[model samples]
Target: MNIKNTTSIFVDCHVFDSGFQGTRTYIQGLYSELIIKRDLHFFLVSSNPDNLASIFGNHSNVTYLKYKYENKYLRLLIDIPQIIKKHKIDFAHFQYTVSPFKRCRYIVTTHDILFINFPEYFSFFSKIINTFLYKQSAKWSEIRLTVSEFSKQKIHQHFGFSNYEITPNAIDNVFFEDYDKVLIKNEVAQKFSLKKYIIYVSRWEPRKNHQMVLKAFLDLELYKEYELLFLGNDTLSNPQYNEIFSQVDSEIKKKIFTLKNTDFNTMLLLLRGADASVYPSMAEGFGIPPLESVAAKIPTICSDKTAMSDFSFFEDYYFDPHNQIDFNDKLQKILKENLGTDFKIMAQKIKEKYSWKKSVEIVYRLIKQNQ
Candidate 1:
């Protein structure tokens, strides 16, 4: 299968080692399609090549490579460059950060400059370091890409070089499939002992606005009927969310549960079984969970802020994240099963516009043109 003149592409798949995040979804979704092309060969790098193999399955054009060093800097400075040279890779793709030293033609996707815009949510050291590193990464790449128009604008406005292309995230096909709600709900209830619940799927951070949604659930008294599920891993410290959670009545607190480190399928099943979903995050690069919830036909209330503003598709369901009253009103409507917009119609529009198939085609064409 060594087709001569095939373009060789090296994908930095370290995100696979980190579970259940947007970057992992993006890499898996995009390259899952890209690996099928006969004229292109993919070298996917991660700490766990066996796990990567399991996820991507057997493909002639795909080769899974393991990292020699566990440290990110050592892998970037030493391991990745060695792999690029050994494989004679024509292009290397990275998320956010890239190797400072030149090796071959490089492509980078800086997902967002959120820290620069929402400096209050970030540490001073983080903001200072990322501002320089992210700018350098974008500057170093042969092609620069981002997840949404909002991110592209932010990158352009701040970074000033302004050539970043948009590679928006797509919903996984599983979310769109028509599953029996009764059957799924029964299975979810039996497996997890969750009778009725509302979910917020995101990695925990200050900017994610977990407290706002948590407060709304209590004030709206939806907790009386449904459990509030906080389903996400802790990335950044969200002390504000905790302070509010700590002050809640113990009886009401009993109805709240926090879940972390759920595998992809488990997350999907839980999401599909929800009474409703709320994405009240104050900041985002390209918010994926709200769309996923909507695609699963879950009644969803999304925050109309930052990058999420582009998701006008949520229509009347979009509410103010900062306003507790607005959050509560929207949450109450969805909890009462008042799905304002026709979700089926909205979901179709999402499928048509945002898909890995379409995204990969654009990326492939761009690569071919640049090459």
Candidate 2:
């Protein structure tokens, strides 16, 4: 350690340029707090250094570095290791996988090992490769972390990684800000030409259960009054969603919209304008969208599967992702029954329970101990 009493750390920031996703959210939320501490020096590296700088403003303890190679292996093996040595980093934190050749004390947060538990959702090869890389990364790390108790348990059971702490995702305070919903909706309707709508914010993947959400929207005939908006980038092929859309009438099809890779501010505007939010993902490390919806004070119906079950505040709104009937009943009730009063009650609980400040502090403490 240096005489200055500061612990230098390197953070892999490649995920920031990959658009809005869970991992990006985790890193941005965690470090936005960690970088404020004068005792900790953070070297954040990415291909897009400008975007990193814009997100995280200047601080005395913070530094932004850029990646040389676009290739994953080269960046991991050559670029990062060299940076660690040059900067004299005391510790390095990686999202899921760490550099194979360690240059400093490594801290890895394998957000989840979902493939090990829900083998059907992931491909055979993906499962094999990720299991190997993630397991090895955990094994090499001096301290390990994950997003939820469910994820922590899965890691231990599958990879025998016992030295891990859960640093869960929390709803950002921006979502809870008091904004006039009618005005936001009116602006959204004018700008995007969107009418009364329900929202589902997740990438298009079979495991994310997009098809089921589409089916429920169609079956319930809610489109007559509300447009169904699927907001996210497509990652995997969902043949079922295609098949369902093909059979539906043109008017019914017109009522459903898919907005891809919109900026974060637009996402928030759309979320605020939503009549309701539906998150029916089959599995998750820690479900952020549902919590975000609750924070936005919108009536949300979420799946009670995997880590999402921890969001027990959505009790009446919870449904089985695999069961269409259960989802239908809950969805029907959430929309028909005005839940404004209920939202206030749920919002208080959500705010009180989870916080990015709390989550990030725990992670920082763990890293400082190991550093």
Candidate 3:
């Protein structure tokens, strides 16, 4: 249980950037907590050298190791093992499904088992790589970490690994602040030039089910008065998505604005001010947007499927992700009711269960238990 005696723990991931995704935020939060406690020495192994000092900076006990690989396959074959021995790492934590080396004790964090259940979203090469890596990582990992119990079940059902532990993701404390909702709303409305808007905060991926969201929004007879803000990565990066984007009607296109590359603070402000947050993803390990929205005291509607439904706060708020009619009904209800009493109570409940400090404590315990 004495973590201070451990020489070093290396975090292996594609990038350490804060804006990358939910996993990066989880790692950064835990890293920050560990630094303050001075209980563990941490090292981040990332692909980008530019991010090394900037993202991690000069922490007395933490170091950044630049890990370059021609490809993930090459990294598994060459670099990962070399770094483990070179740094004398006591334990290695692979943020993604794969670990490059097996010489030392390792822990692998499975964000989701989406690839195993839905392979069509990924290319043939990606599917093969993910299947191989995830299975191997699950089998080899001394301790496995997952974001939710739902994800743990999926991993066991598909990949047949059952030794993993759960560590739910958390919202930053800044998100739970008492900001003037009316003022924030006014700022967002003026900035985006809108009367009212629905919000979707997620990556523009097929699994995210954004097309369905757009279709549901269009289905709404009331949509003429309100717009839907699609905030995240630009769908233009992918050719298929780009083609879909180009063919949209001009009127719909005007209402639909995709603001790519916004900072974290701005994102929180937008979420706080939105009329309602809609996330109808087909799959997820731990959906953070709904959690964040609830923390910000905003009404949120998420798919009833996946771990998102497991939260007590979402019991009355969830809608079926697959059914357009269900989403349409929920959207109408949100617009009509607009932060109902039930919604306010749920938001309060979410703040109690999902906090950054609580989540960090879970990570701290997991590290100590395995150490």
For candidate 1, which ten residues in a row score worst on lDDT?
333-342
Which parts of model 2 have CA positions greater than 4 angstroms off?
Answer: 1-5
lDDT of 3 by residue, 1-371 (tens): 34357557877655453244778777766566656656677777777755665755677777777767747667766777888788778778777655555778887888887777777666778778777878887788887888888989988898888777787787767777788878988988877675477888987777788776677666674468777787786432344445665876788778876777886767876787788789888778888888777777777788877777787667757888788788888877777785667766876777677666775676677767877
Rate residue 234 of model 1 by lDDT.
86
Which residue pairs of candidate 3 clash?
none
Cα-based RMSD of candidate 1? 1.4
Candidates' C-alpha lDDT: 0.88, 0.88, 0.74
TM-score of each: 0.97, 0.97, 0.86
lDDT of 1 by residue, 1-371 (tens): 88347899999988877757889988989998888788998899999999999988988888889999888899889999899888898889998898776788888989899999999999999999999999998888888889999999899899996777788899888889999889999998899888899999999889998989788777778777889898988899889888988899999988898899888889999999998899999989999999999899888889999989998888889998888898888888877775635788778888887999888887898889878
Q: Candidate 3 has what TM-score? A: 0.86
Residue 47, candidate 3: C-alpha displacement in angstroms: 4.7
After superposition on all C-alphas, the RMSD of every candidate to the true structure, in Å, is 1.4, 1.7, 3.4
- Candidate 2 lands at a TM-score of 0.97
Residue 282 accuracy (lDDT) in model 2:
93
